[model samples]
Target: MKKVFQLILIIFSILNSAQQSEIFKLKNYRISVLNDSIQETSGLNFFSEKLYTFNDSGNPAELYEIDKKTGKILKILKVKAENKDWEALTNDGENFYIGDFGNNAGIRQDLKIFKIPFKNNQLQNDSLKIISFYYPEQQDFTPKNISTDFDLESMIYLNGKLHIFTKEWASKSTTHYTLDPDNFEKQAAQKIETFKTGFMISDAYYFEKKLFVVGYTKKTEVFLMIFNESNSGIFFKNNPWKLYLGSALSIGQIEGIAVDETGIYISGEKFYSPIGNTKPYFYFIPKEKLKF
Candidate 1:
């Protein structure tokens, strides 16, 4: 019986290895190393056909417009909102939404999204609005540190609603939730769906009916998942094409992704570990280089 159990375990290990081997590797896409000003670029978004990014918490409340071919800051837009733990950015053509909801300890009760109107190449910071929300299912305010599953960093604006993806550290999954951008009062985020990504999601982007989500695992393995939008507008119902994007040690901590008709743009923040450190990087992958 012992030999039989050992044989079964060997078979399972082989099958798992084979499955992991099928994941495609992304390579030859490094464009340039990011500037030191935006070393903590946590989110990426395209507004009015221009690429923009911003740092996470502990940085100024500002957005940096960067050149696509070269990772250089072209302009900086100062915001009037508090940074807090701003982790995600999205736009609705007329306004940009900044998500200040990075709850790594899962004890935050003041999750907010800042809405600022952009008109005629100007940001109307005077008319900024704050939208507050909370997870209705979460009854506890305990501090779980990095083990909490309520941390969020990925968001996208779609069809008049803001879609948020949670960074589930303990479960290695992500939960999709939707919130009304027009609502100003504190409300509950409507739970939609959940997907087992096997990694914590950092940032997300939407383009041409496709959703691009990027993140790194605890083992420092970076990955990107491309999901096709369903006819009913629900994502994660279909299996995504998961691609291995290399190790964080070599590529830095990937935290931002932005896709367009031209190509896909990925940004990684400076990462440090006991072993070594990596500088922030920017990468561009042409649409033709991707399988789907």
Candidate 2:
């Protein structure tokens, strides 16, 4: 019996180590500190071959086109919708989806996503659409502050649907849900899959059958997870390649990620804590630099 128990402990140790292995550090990949106008940069996406980002809650409802090389704001486009804690940004080929569902307290009833039309290198704000949704599993309306698992921040567009990943602060996991882009009426998100990410997922980007998610732990440790799509087009069915990016103390609060044929782009909002403060920054990782 003693020998059997010892073997079980050894196996558990090995599994735990594999789950949290530190693969890469992103400190060396930072490109430049972003401008002050978008200090609270929350989400990133590409439209018409241009990189775009916007500030989060309490900021203006505008999107900024940024230079991929220098992190400078090239132009700003106004939106007709409300910012309302916008935390995730994604796009189909013709439209941009902005998720305004950052439910930190987990008591918000107005979770919504704004679908804005983009054409001819301009935003057709007159045709903006709002997608309101709720989690059917959420029974309690009590405010749990930062201890709720229903808060969401990461999202992507795939297979003609909007895929949302919850931040899951209390559970240290993320739940995947899908919403219809054309459904403007109040609807319930369809739960798909959940993964034990061990961190709060802030943003996700999908490219070439691979999904990249970025977030930070409460201890200020930031990480990146890469998962390959399964045969049935599901993520999180297999173990992801989890890489430790860096501490938030040094990297700021990483809140956005976008990928293109060239490589990956990440953005961090200005972060302030009792220990230190980090300015908003932008990072670029070339495709060749990644080993897997």
Candidate 3:
């Protein structure tokens, strides 16, 4: 097909950060396990076309409209907010951003990001619209352990800008920030330049312009970055990240990724806890079998 898409983009330009495997024949995705061990699962979003999961903490703030390809939950939306460790999610068709900022002990001072609006696809209430902010530069543990703890799970809202991704505790590597949820608080985050990515970056999705980032350490990998449209507009800020590492073999904590031309959907949230109770796997990657 174009030489398997230029050899998976030349193995994502020699990008490898652990788990070890560079085969690339990709198109092997199937985790079809709907609702199991999902208590403190994490964030995932798509809103309405189905697939809307959330959790990491508390209350009746649930929503899972799944079935992008048979992970089947069908419908279950209702929120009030208490999803503390919510982590990351993205949407802009109207609402559904939800990312309470997972600050794994970097000492959070109140970092949040919740929108939740949507109407026809239902979900027009429950009082939600909090886009708090933090990280005014105060870091430590230069490379201590637990994977470079910057926290933020994953996010996306391109064009209007809202790209946040970082989960680098002991340094598995990932850092990209740029937010302005319409001036969340008079514009705060603006760094967007760090993806030496070798591993560790738990969730993120941005279809057409393609930017899928999943993660794992003992195995479970997925990375596809392609946001190069010359990055059009007002003194462009940071659309320079380019990395591709996917062909799946280490499928242990793939987290969650979503793209829809009827292809590309992954999830692996078995984070060790009383989650939906244990059994989450829904991988069906295909978009010309993605390369590298």
RMSD of 3: 17.0
Candidate 1 lDDT, 1-292, residue by residue in tens: 7756754564464345336734545447889999999999998999988999999999999999999999899999999988999999999999999999999999999999999998886789999999999999899889999889999999999988999999999999999999999999999999999999988999999888988999977767788889999865589889988877777777889999999888999999999865668989999998888845
Which of the two candidates, 2 or 3, achieves a greater lDDT against the reference? 2
lDDT of 3 by residue, 105-187 (tens): 66666777877787887776674677777665655534333544577788888788788878875666777777778555634
TM agreement with the true structure for every prediction: 0.92, 0.92, 0.33
lDDT, candidate 2, equals 0.88
RMSD of 2: 6.8
lDDT (Cα atoms) of all candidates against the true structure: 0.89, 0.88, 0.62
Q: On a 0 to 100 scale, what is the lDDT of residue 230 in model 1?
A: 86
Cα RMSD (angstroms) for every candidate in the order listed: 5.5, 6.8, 17.0
Q: Write out the backbone clash pairs for model 1.
A: none
Output the number of the lDDT-best candidate: 1
Worst 10 residues of 1 by lDDT: 9-18
Name the better of 1 and 3 by lDDT. Answer: 1
Off by over 4 Å in 2: 1-19
Supply candidate 2's per-residue lDDT for 193: 93
